[model samples]
Target chain A: MGVFTIAKTITGNLFSRPPTSRYPAEPAKRFDLTRGHLAFEPENCRVCRVCMLRCPTQAIVVDREKRTWECDHFRCITCGNCVELCPTDALHLEPAYRSPEADRPGKEFHEIPAPPPKAEAGGETAEA
Target chain B: MAYMKRSPWIIHYDGSSCNGCDIEVLACLTPLYDVERFGIINTGNPKHADIFVVTGSVNEQNREVIRNIYEQMPQPKVVAALGICACSGGVFRECYNVMGGMDKVIPVDVYVPGCPVRPEQIIDGVVKALGVLEEKRARMKAGAPAEVPA
Candidate 1:
């Protein structure tokens, strides 16, 4: 009886498809909530620097004067603090990781255009 | 040099990691991930390795050891920094003993950044490293000077 069970198990293993994921040939498994990487929308960014301040790794640098937002991908841990704290909803956590690179790439920089004068007025009114 | 692509042996070193990334690295070797399909074999000797897989952040204690292993590997090699810690010190960057990422000690060819890198990402990083190895070999074959470590 034991021998029959072992044979059945062996045949089951042999007939079943391999469990390994064909990652490169096919896409890797991803879910809706996966914190793969961070994405920034310069137009929506208020340059409040909240993401910069809240980031534990200090991976974000926002220059309000220059209206520039920069993120060092290497330093980012995908912790989502910036995503959660962005008052303007400028930041988002994407579900696909940044591709691997051969050389250390420079920081991701985006020059946010100055907010429209009317939007600035509205923002101040909302704050008040 | 051509054979390096067919079967690239990698040597892994833990600098000061918390072992989260290391576990993911191990997962890549399991049947589920099975990195061996790409001819990747994790080895123990640096001299036999074509790629260096480093996990964790570099600290004062492990810098020299990391350098020694890097020096032992033959030319036309590649280095893959396997996690956020190995890439840029992760959350430990501010620590007094932590000196930043793998590039601080040795030139890194591929940077894979994750708090604890996923097995799929590890395989992706290794594939990227293989591409780098091919480039280095081509450079060597042309008798060009190897890249100077920054």
Candidate 2:
């Protein structure tokens, strides 16, 4: 009785469709909330340094004076802290993941445009 | 040479890590990722492997072991550092024992950076490693240096 049951199970599995997905041929399904890679739009950033301060790994660096934002891809754990803390909605998590590179990768820096000079009523605008 | 392109056996090793990346590395062997679909075979012995898949960062304790594994693998081999830990020591970089990335110990051919690293990324890294393997083979045939100078 036991042998017959085992045989049935083995045959059942032999003919069943493989659970594996065809990954390269077809892109893998990813969730909207899936944390894969981080993207930054410097133009939208205010250079508040929030993302840099909130990053647990200290992978992000913000230069307010220079209006620059930098993140080390290798050091970043993709923890999403920076993305959540970004005030300007400049940082976001992309569903697509980082691909392998032949050469060792490095940190990327983005330059944000300096804020426009503040307008003064009936007066000249403040120099940036 | 023909078999090298079709079937690239891999030897996986963990240096210093929390094992998050290690689990994801194993996931590639599962049916969901099924790295074997590309004729990849996960092997235990370094002598039989064409690719080295290392998870985690290099630490003082495991430096020798990592080097030994790299040396054991036959020529025309590629190394894929899987995950942020393996690529650059991740959060452990400041640790006294941490020694940075796989590049600190061995020459890394491919770098796949992430926290634990997704199984798909590992598969992608391996596929990229395969391309590097082919290039190395061609270079060896041409009698050029086996590796590009830094």
Candidate 3:
């Protein structure tokens, strides 16, 4: 009992946490160069549907006639190809490595809606 | 040797990829990610591997090669598709050469989802496969399953 307990205790002290994993609490630690989710600015979208054509799973659906665009969060591959090809600088990648719920197959994840058009920054004045 | 057996070897196979996912997969093997501590070795051959990580959606050209590789792998093997492309035929959804995710052909044991799958995410899939390996080993030891893959 004396020897066994001591060895176990010492081993536990020697190696406790997995070095690479800092998960479920602090968020999966993102490396500086890591690419996360791609931000989509629908207003900047040209309706060219290039992103739709390039998506690996067709995760991004564009209905040009309806002027509606939404990304199914569940289906998004986070590949960043859309961000790379966006000519308007509307799409940018942000790293959020952790997907809170990965196993739910039928649930739909949605992107935030585009804000209404605003006055040009230079032309806008203080409201009365 | 005991540790080695516990830490089964895995091999990465790319049929066709845009390279986004491939880079992510390799990131796991790097120091920042450090997948090696888990005993996940990137082996060069199928016979030496317990896990075959197919990273890209299978295309018409690569489909035969993948199948042949799968056949050559020893028994008690598990196939893991490491990205959306390999999992659900991601960006190549409508591509003519790609039939679908790897599951369209192989019995995928675990599916890691990401544009190109995060290092931790891929680790999650590997952990799941390890569970399957444990179960199969237990069944074999109990003499309940004869054909269980090693």
Candidate 4:
């Protein structure tokens, strides 16, 4: 009885598909909440510097005056601290990770364009 | 590129790590992520390895151990820094004993950034290191320097 059970198990193992996924040939599995890398959208940014202040690793740098935001990929821990703290929802954790690099690609910089001046009520508008 | 005739063997070392990245590194060897299909074997001795996988941040004490392991690997070798800690010291950068990333002690061929790197990312880093290994082999074949100055 034991011999027969062992033989059946061996047959099943021989015919079954391997558990390993072909990672390089195929894309790795990703989840909706996977924290692979940090992303910043400059357009939605208010340059409040909230993420910069709360980041544990100090990987984020926000220049309010220049409207520039930067994150050092190498230094970042992908902990989602800045993503949650972003008041304007400008920061997010992307599902696709930053690819490995041969050398350090310094800090990723984004220059947020200054918002256009609001028009005053019953005032002459300046035409470009 | 065609020069590689054998599978690349790797040796893993843990510096002053929290063991988070090390667990992920071991996960790469499990059936779910099985790195063996790529002809990557995890070896114990540094002399028998072609790739060095290091986890954690360098500190005052383990710096020498990291250097010794790096120096033991043969020529045409590649080093893959497997986590944010190994890449740039992670949260321990401010620690008094921490000396930053693996680059502080040895040349790093690939940098995979994650708090505790996922197994998929580790595979990606290893694959990237293979490319670097090929280039280094080519340089060695041509009688040129294997590593460029930092």
TM-score for each predicted model, relative to the true structure: 0.92, 0.89, 0.61, 0.91
Every candidate's DockQ is 0.70, 0.75, 0.18, 0.67
RMSD in Å for model 1:
2.9
For candidate 4, write residues A1-128 as lDDT tens digits. Answer: 99999999999999998788877678989999998898888877766677888888989887866778899998998899887777668889989988888787657999988765552121221111
TM-score of 2: 0.89
Candidate 4 error regions (>4 Å):
A118-128, B1-6
lDDT of 1 at A97: 86
Give Cα distance to truth, residue B109, candidate 4, Å: 1.4
Tens digit per residue, CA lDDT, model 2, A1-128: 99999999999999998788878778977999888889999777776677877677788988866767888898888888877766567889998888878776577888887666652121221122
List all candidate RMSDs to the true structure.
2.9, 4.5, 9.6, 5.4
| Model 3 vs. true fold: TM | 0.61
Better of 2 and 3 by lDDT: 2
Please report, in order, the local distance difference test score of every candidate based on alpha carbons: 0.86, 0.84, 0.68, 0.85
What's the interface RMS deviation of candidate 4? 1.0
Q: Model 3, range A3-115, lDDT digits (tens) per residue?
A: 99999988997887655554323457776657766666655655555676676666777665565666755467676777776555667777665342323252333333444
Which candidate model has the greater DockQ, 1 or 3?
Answer: 1
Select the stronger candidate by lDDT from 2 and 4: 4
Q: lDDT tens string, model 1, A42-92? A: 989877778888899999998867779999898898999888877888899
Off by over 4 Å in 3: A1-27, A31-56, A60-74, A79-95, A98-106, A109-128, B1-5, B142-150
Residue B40, candidate 2: Cα error in Å is: 0.9
Candidate 4 or 2, higher DockQ:
2
